[model samples]
Target: MLVAGTTRTAEIEGISAAGADSDLLVHTPSADAEILTYGEPIRAPVVPVSPSGCPTPAVVTRAVRELIGLDVTVVDGGLAEPTGAPTVTVGARPGDDVREQDPVSTAPGVLAAAREFGRAVPDDEVYLAETIPGGTTTAFGVLRALGETPTVSSSLPENPLELKQEVVRDGLTASSLEPGDAAGDPADALRRMGDPVLATITGLLVGLVEGDTAVTLAGGTQLLAAAALARHAGVETTLRLATTSFVAGDESVDLETAARALNVDLTVTDPGFENRDHPAMDAYVAGEAKEGVGMGGALALADAAGVPMEDVRERIVTVYDRLLDGRDPAEPQP
Candidate 1:
C-alpha cells in the first residue's frame, strides 16, 4: 500500500484577519518541505517562523519517505506561491478570501479532476493527505453549512476562536447562506464557503471508493469536512481519519466529537515529540503547527506498518536538525 496525496495553496490563507498565519509568516514553507524532500536536497528549505517556532513539514515528510518509501503526488489546486515541487495543475485561480468573497469558484471542475485522478490511482490502498493552508477555517465554514456547529483546530497554540468565527460569519453573510442552508447540498455548501482542497479531497474520497480502494484521509478538521461532504454526496464507504495527539489535545476544539458525529473512524498518533531534544519538535508539544502535510496520518500508517515509534521519533529529529543546520536561531529567513 502506497501513500498517495495532493497539495493546494488557498489564498484564504493570506487573510490576516482570519487569525491563521499559515501563509503569512514563513511564506508557507510546508509546501516546499513536502515534495522537495522527495527530490534533491533543498539547499534552502522553507522553515516556519512564529513566536513558538512551528514544526516544519520536512520532518514529517522525511519520516514518511524513510518509513514507507512513497513520494507525494503534488496537485496544484491553487497556490499563492507555486511550490518548488512539480505539480498537477487542476486549478488556475487561487481561492479568494472567504471573508470578502466566495473562496471556491472552481469546485465542480476540481471535483471532476480529483475523481478522475482517484480512479487512476495504481495503489490498492492509499493514505491520502493534503497541504492546504487555512483549511481549518474553511472546514469550520463547511461544517456550519452542513448543519454541524464545529470548533475546528488550528496550527497556532492559542486558538483564535473569535477571529475564525468572525471570518466564517462574514463569509456566510457575503454568500447569503445561513447555517444549515446547504446541508442537503454538499456542492452548494462548498461553493458557498469551502475551498479547493475541500472539494478535491471530497471528490477523491468518492472516486477512490468507486474504484474499490480503501482510503484514509490524513489530516485534522479539514478531513472531517471532506468526509462529511462525501457522506452527504451519498458515499457510503467507511473512511478513516488519522491525526496527531496534539490535535486531539487541542482544548480549542473537540475533534473526537466532530469525527463521531460524521461517523468517520478516527486514529490519533502520538509521536512523543514532547520527549525529543529538538526545538522544533518541542514546538509541536507546545501546540504550534499541530498537524499538516499529513504528519499524523503518516505516523499512523508507519505504526500500522510496524515501524517502531522510537525509530519514527529519531528520523523526525534527524531531519529537523539537518533542515535547521547552521541557521540563525534569532533571525528567520524565507
Candidate 2:
C-alpha cells in the first residue's frame, strides 16, 4: 500500500515549481493524490503540471500502481482543499510557513493518531510517500534541527538552493532552534520546523516497525528527513528508501549521501522515460518534477515484480495521454 500525505506548504512563493500557477500549488498534493487514486484529478480542472508543462510525478505513480496492482491511501495530513479522493484524516491542520513559530502545533497529536493508523494497517509492508509543495525546504529545516546538513531535492530542474537555505535559516531562528537542537527530541523538531506530513510519516514508520511490518519510504529527501527523525526517535529497524534515478542523477542534491548518513538502504530505479517519445517523459529526462507521489517506489516495485521498463514507460504515456484528452484512450470517442 502507498500512503500519500498532502500539505499546504507548497503555497510558499518561489519555494516550489510544482504547479503551473503558483496559486494552485497547495492543490497539487490533493490533485496528485486524486490522480494516483482515480487516474485523473477530480477536483482540479486538470492534472497538476510544472511551469514547464511537465506532468506531475503522480502520472508515473498512477501508471505503476495500475501495472503492479498496488493499493493507495491518501492522508489529509493538512489540506487547504478537501480531496475528492478518499483519505485518512490524522487530526492535522494545514501547515503554515516554516519560518513562523509553531508551524505544526498539532504535530504531537497528529503523530499519535497516525501511529495508531499505521499500527492498524493490515499490510505487512507499506510504502510511505508524500505530495507537499515546498516539502524540500521543510525537510531541510527538520534535518537541520536534527543536526544534519542536508542538500534537499527539488521538483524543478535547477534547485533553488539559496532560497531554501534562507528559508531554513530564518525558520530555525524564528523557532529559536540551533542545528541539532532537537536531536534528542524529534517531536520538538516537528512542533517548530516540520510539517504534518513529516510527523505523520515518522509516526507511521515507528508504528509499522513496532508492529514488525517491513516498510519502504518512497521519495527522495522528504522520506530521508522522515527517516532521520525516526532514527533520532530510536527506531533502529532497518528501513529502505526508494526513489527514481532522476533524483539520484540530480547534481543539485545528493540523495545517496543522505541515505548513507541516515543508514537507510537506498534503491534507485530508471523508468526508461528518456527513450519515450512523449513530452511528459522527456520532461523527466530534462530533470523537471524529479520525484514525488511515490513515483520512485512504484518504479522500484515494478522492477521487483518483473515488469519490463519499456512496459512501464508505455503505460506512463498511456496515462499521460488519457489525462491530456481528459478521458481514457481506451474509452470510445463520441
Candidate 3:
C-alpha cells in the first residue's frame, strides 16, 4: 500500500497503517517517486532555508528500491516546479495564512484515482499518507470546528495549537457573519492555500477504491482529518494510524481523541518509534516537528510493500544519525 501527500518543512512523516508490527502495512510515495507535485503561493508567509516537505522521499525511495526491490516509476502532474525546490525552500512557517480547501471535493477526486490504482496494484490492500505543510494547523482547525478542544499549548497552545485557536475563532467568526454561506468550504480553502498534491492524493484514493483494494488511510493529523471527512461524507474505508510518526505530540493530537470523536476504531501499524534511537522522536524534541501524521502513513506503506521493518527503522535512525553526524545536505552542494 502507498499514499503520500501534504508535506511541510522536512517532510518529516509520510503515512502508516499502525505503529509497529501490524498486519497490513502502509506507506506513502516520495516526491522523487510521486506521479508529480503541485502548489501555488497562497500569500501564506513562508521561511527560507527551513527544509520543507517530507523527509521520506530519499528514505522511501531508497527503502522501496532496496527492500521492495523494484525501480518504481516517477511522474509529474503539471506543477512540476512551483518556484520552490521541495518544500524546504518555502516553509509554511506554522501559521493560519497557509490554507487548503476542505478537500471535500478533492478527496473524492483523489479517491477516484486511488480506486483505479488499487485495482492495478498486485496487493489486495492499500494505504495512504499526506504531504500538507502546516497541515497540523488545518487538522486542528477542522477538529476545533467540530467542537473539540483538540490542542493545549502553554504558549497559547504551541504551533498548531495556536494556529488552530486562530482558525477556529476565524471559522466561528466567519460562520457567525455569513450564517448561511456554508460557512466555508474545506475544498475551496485548500484550493486557495492547499498544494496540488492534496487533490492528487484524494484522487488516487478514490481511484484505488474503485479498483476494489481494501483501504487503510495512513498519516498523522491530516489522514485523521481526511478519514473523518470521508466517513462523514459516506466514503467507506478502514482507517489506520501509522504509529511511527512524531508529527504530532501526544498532548496535542492523540488521534485517539479524534477517533473517539468519530466513534471509529483507528488501527495502527508499528510502535518502532518508541525506541530511544528513533529520529522522529528526536525531531520533536529538537522542535523541528510536532506531528508524525505523514511519517506514520509512509512507514505503513513501506511495511505493506514488504520492506523489512528493521530496514525502515534503520533508515530513519540513520537519516537523523547522519544529520547529527554533522553531514548536512546543504554542505555547499558542490
Candidate 4:
C-alpha cells in the first residue's frame, strides 16, 4: 500500500529548507508525490519536482511496477489535492502542524478507516510506503510522546536537528504533553502530535496483523514511529522497516538504534546511486530527498524478486530523464 498524506507543518517557513523549487517544496507533501508514484502526469499535468534534480518517488515506483510487477494501492490519509489514481480517503482535514495545534483532529476516524482498509487488503504480504512532507518533525514529536529520545532524518543535505527539536518542543508544550506522558497510549500520542498518515499506518499495521498479513513499512523515521505505535498497540505479526541507505547512513539520526528499541526489524536498500551518472541519483548521495514514497522498499523487493540492480538503476534514470526533460521516454533523445 502506498499511503500519501500532507501535514501543514511543511508550510512553516524553514521547516523544509531544501527542494528544487519553492513550488516543488510545497507540492512534495501535496498530491504531487502520489502523481509521481503513478509514473505519469495525472491530476497535476506535470512531473513532481524535487530539489535533488534527479530521483523522485515516481522513478522508483515506476521501476518496481515495471520490473517486479508489484501492484500499487494508494491510500489517502489527507491530501491537499485528490490523486488521479484511485485512493481510499481516510481523513477529512489535512493535519495541522503540531507546533501550532493538535495535529490529528480526526485520529479515531482515520484509524478506523485504516483498520478497514487493512482488513480489506487481499495480499498476504504488503509493502507499505508514504509521502508526507515535514514528516520527520512529526515523527520526532510522536517518538518523544512515546518516551523515546529520537534523532530523526531529513531531506536536506544537513539534517536540521535543532530546528526540528524546537518545533517538537513547541508542539509538546502546546499540547501539554510532557515526555513519556503518552507512552502507554500510542493512539493518544498520535492524536497529540502525529499526522493522519502516521495514525493511519499505525492502525493499518495493527489491523493487518489481526488479519494474518505480514507487512513491511517502507520509509524512514516516520515509519519507525508507526512501528513503535504498533508495538504499543500489541501488534505481533511479521513486520520490518525498510528504507534507503542514505537514511541508514545519516549521522543525524540513529534509525537502526530506534528500530532495535522498538523491536522492529530494519533493512536498507543500497541502490548504488552514488555510482550512477545522474544528478538526481547523485543528489541522493549528497543527502537530498533521501527517501520517500517507498523507494527503498520497492527497490529491495525488486532485488529480492531477482531484478538486476543495474537494470533497476537504468530504469530509474530513464524515468527521471523523461520527467526532467518533459518528453516521453519513447521519443528519441536530441
Highest lDDT: give the candidate number. Answer: 2
> Taking the tens digit of each residue's C-alpha lDDT, what string does model 4 give over 58-166?
5676777777777777777777665677777766357888986668888878887788778777789987888777888888888898887776888777888888888
State how far residue 103 of model 4 sits from its true place (Å). 2.0
| Better-scoring candidate (TM-score), 2 or 3 | 2
Model 4 C-alpha lDDT versus the unseen true structure: 0.74
Q: What C-alpha root-mean-square deviation, in Å, does candidate 2 show against the real structure?
A: 3.2
Candidate 2 lDDT (Cα, 0 to 1): 0.83
Clashes of 3: 90
- Candidate 2 residues lying further than 4 Å off, grouped into runs, are 1-8, 326-334
Tens-digit per-residue lDDT, 1-334, candidate 2: 4444444456667778777766767677777888899998777555678777788899998998889889888887777766788988888788888889789998899888888888887887889998887888888888889887776889888898888888889999999999999996788898898888888888888888888788999998888899998998899877899999999999987777778877899999998876766877888888888898888899999999999999898898888888877543222223
Shift of residue 71 alpha carbon in model 4, Å: 0.4
Q: Sort by TM-score, best first: what order?
A: 2, 4, 1, 3
TM-score of 2: 0.94
TM-score (C-alpha, index-matched) for candidate 1: 0.87
Query: Model-by-model lDDT, in order?
Result: 0.68, 0.83, 0.39, 0.74
> Model 3 over residues 1-334: C-alpha lDDT tens digits?
3323332211222222111111111112222223212211122111111232213333432333344443232212122123222331111112123222322223334434443554475656555544433455545444444444443221112344444555545554543422122213433333333333443444445555556766555555555665554443355655455544344445555667766665545655553444555443443344443333234545556767767667776755554343334334222111
**lDDT at residue 70 of model 2 (Cα atoms):** 90
